[model samples]
Target chain A: MSNGYVFLSIAAMAVTTYLIRMLPMAIFRKKIENRWIKSFLYYVPYVVLSAMTFPAIFTSTGSVLGAASGCAVAIMLAYFDKGLLTVAIGAAAMAFIVQFAGM
Target chain B: MNLKEVKEGIKVGIPIALGYFAVSVAFGVSSVQSGVPFWGATLISLTNLTSAGQKAGVDVMAAGGSIFLIVLTTLIINMRYFLMGVSMSQKVEEKMPMWKRLLIAFGITDEIYAMSMSRSTHLTGSYMAGLIIPPIFGWTGGTLVGSVATGFMPSILAEAMGIALYGMFIAVIVPPSRRNGNVLLGVISAVILSVAFTYAPVLQIFSEWSVIIITVLVSAFMATFFPVKEGADNE
Candidate 1:
């Protein structure tokens, strides 16, 4: 909770993220020919996004029902290929409406 | 350093900047709600343009997680950028200098990478600067606005806005999941694992590491069992 710790955490995150983005461009000139590594990297973003969204999402709003309603709206909109802004706003609006109704 | 190419890149980047503004607004609001200071949240956006990585980083930081955990979580969440960097190294013009490469590396988010790779022509420093600068402003500006706006907003509205980031995440993964069975399975597997970590008593202790663990396990399993076809669309 200290400012020092917060600064360190941010610094660590920035350095780690930058290194991941920088190292390959700085050093590697050849393509990664390894199929398995390539596939794993390809799938990582999806897996990470899924893990972060679910369960955590159910608690994002005031109540589980509100969160669920919002989540459903989001999934429905996204399933139809809605843009990120649309899906986000739709989910927030749904949650607001549900919670406002005291459901 | 063609000004014309830079202008073209900026033109192409306009939509991406708009999209990043919306998402980073969500990020700023969510991180502040989770206890990150307004300035800290903005700094995170400035330094790390990535959505998922910054989200996970803020979670760890707000939890009072150790520096090691923060670095590890960010590293794992952003490992995909390594591939992007490699792909970009090959995509940019061959004579691009080291300093330019290093500087441009800082801006290689998923969207930027995808845009650069999709181009029929080789990437240039000026074009990349044009493409990267707007999104940086959009992302950092949105965070600043959201972080400041959180103080004036009602608590209920703030809470509702928390779902915005997750909704964006869903928008990102769901389309791809619908297209690729492997991606769908990877998503489901991660969700199951994440849920188990939250609910199961023994697994509760490791919940802090759940994102990395679930990501690695599910991704590795899918890669081993159902590797994407060699020539398949990576984007």
Candidate 2:
């Protein structure tokens, strides 16, 4: 793809992403009290995070073993109530070691 | 936005920014390696804070994908932002001006939305603004460094940083899930559905947007089958 195509793709993505994000804030004005909608909203964070993390995590670092090595450390540290930086960077470090070890 | 709220917002966002810097470094390397210029990568990160869409856009460009496909794929992959925005629309104080709300929407990533929403009190535009700044700079700055330093870093180090963002996502959810059974159930359900969606050949067609669909379905499932007491959110 040419440089123009790359810029064009970025523009397209930015506009679409911005509009999607803006629409919700632009439209919904009050607290949603409906049990179903409320519940759905409540769980959105966990659902989105888990959906994006799992399986995807196993492949994110270019190797399933490396990713899993990192993720296992992440879960343990996070379960022990580690800080975000510690758990996240620690996982990366562990993955780096695993990958460096030729895994 | 008061100075204090902005300070607190930056504080809450500091960890996110730290994580973003590490991850966007990977994004920088990937986009540049995929043939996107340094400035192009920087521009994408600045305008689109999305991790996947920005990275994937470069992938599409490298593969010679059509503009229509690029736009459509990003739209589908990023549809979750709409869900997040809708949810946040309710949480941010109704008194916040429309422009503030719109600007707040720009900073609504998975981590930001989760942190913003999970707070006990209503969000002000100032607070959200404070929250948004660090991650934006962290993301863009990392991309700039990564793209410029392409091939300068060892693959092992870069690979390690590659997974840090996912670890951040896990860190964000782990505490809440441990404290709240409803959250745990919702997470488990979403993970199960994600696995099913990934492996179930019939579900493969929705591959790109499966996360959005599964999230919506699992969230609704939690709401309907396992509603939690309202006070649970006060934490």
Candidate 1 regions with alpha-carbon error over 4 angstroms: none
User: With candidate 2 superimposed using the best TM-score fit, by how many Å does residue B27's alpha carbon deviate from the native?
Assistant: 3.7
Q: Label model 1 with its docking quality class.
A: high
| Residue-by-residue lDDT tens digits, candidate 2, B1-235 | 4888888788899888877887787678767766788899899999999885675566567767777877876775576677678779888886888889889989989789889987898998778877899999999999999888876777667666768767877887898889878788888888888888788999977766666577668877888888766644522
True contacts kept of each: 0.84, 0.75
Interface RMSD for all numbered candidates: 0.9, 4.0
For each candidate, what TM-score against the reference? 0.98, 0.74
Please report, as a residue range, the 10-residue window in candidate 2 chain B with the lowest summed lDDT.
Answer: B226-235
Q: Where is model 1 chain A poorest over a 10-residue stretch in terms of lDDT? A: A1-10
- lDDT per model, in order? 0.90, 0.79
Weakest lDDT window of 10 consecutive positions for candidate 1 chain B = B226-235
Give one digit per residue, the lDDT tens place, for model 2 in A22-103.
9878975444456665566667667777887877788777578989999999998998889777887888888888888888
Give the per-residue lDDT of model 1 (tens digit) for A17-83. Answer: 9999899999977788899998998899999999999899999988789999999999999999998
Model 1 / residue B11 / CA error / Å: 0.7
Native-referenced Cα lDDT, model 1: 0.90
